[model samples]
Target: MKDTFTETVLEVRGLTTTISGKRGEFTAVENVDLTLKRGETLGLVGESGSGKSLTGLSLLRLVPKPAARIAAGSVVLDGIDLMSLTEDQMRQVRGRKISMILQDPQTSLNPSFTVGSQIAEALALHTDTPRKSLRDKAIEMLRRVRVAAPEHRVDAYPHQMSGGMRQRAVGAVAISCAPDVIIADEPTTSLDVTVQAQYIRLLQELQRESGMGIIFITHDFGIVAKVCHRLAVMYAGQIVETGPVAQIFDQPLHPYTRALLSSVPKLHGQIGRLPSIEGTPPPLWDRPRGCKFSPRCPLADHRCRNEEPPTVDSPAPDGSEHWARCWKPEAI
Candidate 1:
């Protein structure tokens, strides 16, 4: 078996997803490229409708049918191209190798079945463990996620558990088979502040123990700071900036990235009021002709409006390097 700890478990290159609308095909995600190393966390952050969640779903080939399609690009997980897989072939890889914890656990979990039964079923489907050993494995997985009294809670239904518990249970199922990569899509959205912190810490612990690469999808910069080693900022279906967490936060280059950081309310700073990014995000259907963010960007010039910029390597404050896609990235 390949040592997943040292390998690039997932590589997503030029991923683009499109949906058929009443008028015509609209691009949901465009030219997204991401790579997740084993046992590392890559935080994907963006505003609503910025294609963060859609990109996460596309990684597992789980985009909704008929309307949504992976229009272009390759999703390579462990050297296997997900786009090229048949339904049956993809099934074997989905939960066992690359699992996803969805945004809402209440809707994702089965209302009729007990949480333990659901988790056991996942294990049985993905692994060759005997029926007698499945419950123990389920309980073990639950305990690993820091669920107290796992044996008792295992028999409880989704409704019996609190929102945090339900989310943890959903996580239990996703990581039950010890997947090589876990795509957590807004896992903390339904939890309270304290519980959200605990859940994130638990995920970090689990990632450390299992050596699983994590792709954390969230809109909150606070959460990104807490869990992510590196960050990717998406805008209008494309990545505008990517760098280490410290670099991206301290010395942002892209206009959109700078605007986002400036908008964040800081505790120490005495800037009268928080800086807000001007204008709303561009609609996917009515995307701008050149740079997608050019219309709303403060530094936009004729070149920005007429020509798309290429992503260029840049130096960070700490001597590290990152890339920003802009015609005129700000000097830090």
Candidate 2:
């Protein structure tokens, strides 16, 4: 028997998504690879336009249609290939086998409907719970997320709830079906620090109880450190580095990863101005010839600028293989 702690819940390989418009088609997600284990939280961190959000959407086959589509790669969830499923089958998979907690509760929750009705809608779509009992189940879910006076709040509309409460309601919707995996796409972006910490703790408690794997997408390294066990750094739609969180935090191999870590403000030392990475990520259509980050990387040389770096495997202190895409990871 495989160890439960190490059991793979989701595996993605060479996952590429394309976006189409009047500007034509461009790769928005390129050859991205990820693995999530049972009960583990994997942080997907990068700047805006780094494809962190799109990667999560693509994993669930929820990429906006007509405008963007998944052109390549495979997403295997619990040994089932999601790419092979038909639209109807995929609908069944969503909210049942897997779920997503989008970043904004305001957008996620319907202002027209009571929070209970929205949660009941999810339960109805995915489960066999009788119609009469869905409200009870919804209330139970609200309680699970630690909502105050869940019974009263359950009947309130989205606009009536606090930002944190609304986010918790969104979480209740996501976990209503007991999915094997949950993709939380910057779920704490709108909340205050206290509320964000509470939300993280709530997610941790839920994961502990359900043993569900989570792909936590965020731009905040502090939140990543608090919640994620592994880390994947994205750049220009591609994953540049991935490994155990502590190992990567201590010894980041990719230049972009190092630069990102360097920019984070420190608490222990004398307060000083934060270091900033120069230049923004390139547009998808205008990505550089070799390494996408080479243009901005201080360590880039002729080799890095002229040739694409292959993903290299380095031994991590935690006995896991740390993967980095760079010509000279040692130079950093």
Candidate 3:
């Protein structure tokens, strides 16, 4: 089947996450809106603590309790509001229709269960296959992920596998049920470059075959260029710029996005000193009154410091739409 689907699979509107700390209530994610069309890859690029991971977690309703809560907003998947679903109903959606591959595969995988058993458990929950068929299917999944000697590796525990192997194992389990959407949060973090490349290729191939909508979270703009069809640059807790990958690389709109792209290291020529965005991101509790990035933005004016920018529509050269939230967006 063609990967591209006309239907929209996921829609996040004005999604916000607030937590009550010992000090006071603070918003980790604020007024963030994103959408994922069926079978499309939306790369979410942001620095640490920018709430990219939190946003992904919120999509699955897996945010930690007590400390975290969806303060306000709606998460709709396939026309169903995920925020309104019961715990059991959400669980049914997770690992089956909507799955996630956490940042650290080594920590995410169970140390006690064999790789095969873990994958089988995920399959069993979502499928009606019998015991024997389930085991066979698990092995097939391992093979599909290109795990060498899948039959032998299936019985091996997570600790028995290498870092790359464990990640592949996680991928196998995540895709075993052929989810409609897969949110991979830094899936290649800390891995060797070669391994990261292979993992990314695996994911792309699988996504292409399964027609899965992907939300790939990463800090690397280069990685985003390689895999994502479209890109969303996040700063503080909101998407500042969103557009096609080519447009984002060629003509970035938001100042933060431009700064992020400028920071990527090149292989040749006199490597110019990477231009760093001055000033640190504000603490959630200490967010500015207007634009959160105004302190670091070179284009910031009085209005930028006093009023938040609205998302303005801008079309890319390829006819793909781009939107940026900035009072002084870069001119075309």
Candidate 4:
């Protein structure tokens, strides 16, 4: 069956994260707004440096200190304004209310701590479980992620596990508290194809069990196709288009969105080389005056260059979703 999403679990508005250096302030993510419903997955797709990862960090108020910060935005999680919370309150919300599965486990996991200790620590921090039962809970969490020999493996340090096992261990920790939402930042990036597929199914199973919302961040359209209920395509730090996954894949409105979908590698039958987007992304510091994608957009005109394109929100026939920031949606 298709997604049966109902209630909105997360709503973001005007979310911007910026970094400062001698050259001046550069916006890593600008005025980004997105919604994720309970029991639904939203795919955040774009090339590296498109601010996808930064946007995820900003939602959790984890943007690196001093160098980068969430300059402006409202992050509302289940009617509560996350942006308005105090540091202590936000800390409470981080692993308990909202969790994150980072891109890499080798760097994310502390080598000194045993896998069991790390997972138990997360449960201890969030729940009132007695210290004695924490170890059992940690083992159960590992089992939930389909880790083999959880009882014994939990005692091993991260370095002792395979890459896939470490990733699964990280997943165990991320979902340990049964968070309302999980921000998966390309969690499958480093895994081989087989392991990647397994991890994806593991995540889907966990989401089904908990009805948690997920923001799956990746540039792989195939992953988007496999998991996402909706799509949000970013380019050079801005979301150029967003809509239901089927609608956007079938009929992308923005040129950049179309290009991205077109570049997805086909697998069914024999085909020539895969298509790719032309030109590199605009440098953040020297970004063009108007639409950041205008320079490479084929349909771009004088208006597109000099003015920010207005968003055209055309609702789908199924009442699913549709929206595009382009001067010429009719052209598509």
For each candidate in turn, give its C-alpha RMSD to the true structure in angstroms.
Answer: 2.9, 2.0, 1.8, 1.2
**Taking the tens digit of each residue's C-alpha lDDT, what string does model 2 give over 1-332?**
11236799999999999999887999999999999999999999999999999999999899999899999999999999999999999999999989999999778898999999999998999889999999999999999999999999989999999999999999999999999999999999989999999999999999999999999999999999888988999999999999888889888999899999989887885587888999889998778988999999998989888899998888774577588999989634
Could you give candidate 4's per-residue lDDT for residues 14-65 as a string of tens digits? Answer: 9999999777999989999999999899999999989999999999999988
- Summed over model 1, clashes come to 0
Q: Stretches of candidate 1 above 4 Å error?
A: 1-6, 315-321
- Residue pairs in steric clash, candidate 3? none
For lDDT, the strongest prediction is 2
Ranking by TM-score: 4, 2, 3, 1
Candidate 4 regions with alpha-carbon error over 4 angstroms: 330-332
Query: Whole-model Cα lDDT per candidate?
Result: 0.88, 0.92, 0.88, 0.92
List model 3 lDDT by residue over 124-178, tens digit each: 9999989888778989999999999999999999999999999999999899999
Per-residue accuracy of model 1 over 188-302 as CA lDDT, tens digit each: 9878999999999999989889989999999888898888887899999999998888878877889898888888777798869788888989988889888999989888989
Candidate 4: give the clashing pairs.
none
lDDT measured at residue 304 in model 2 versus the true structure, 0 to 100: 89
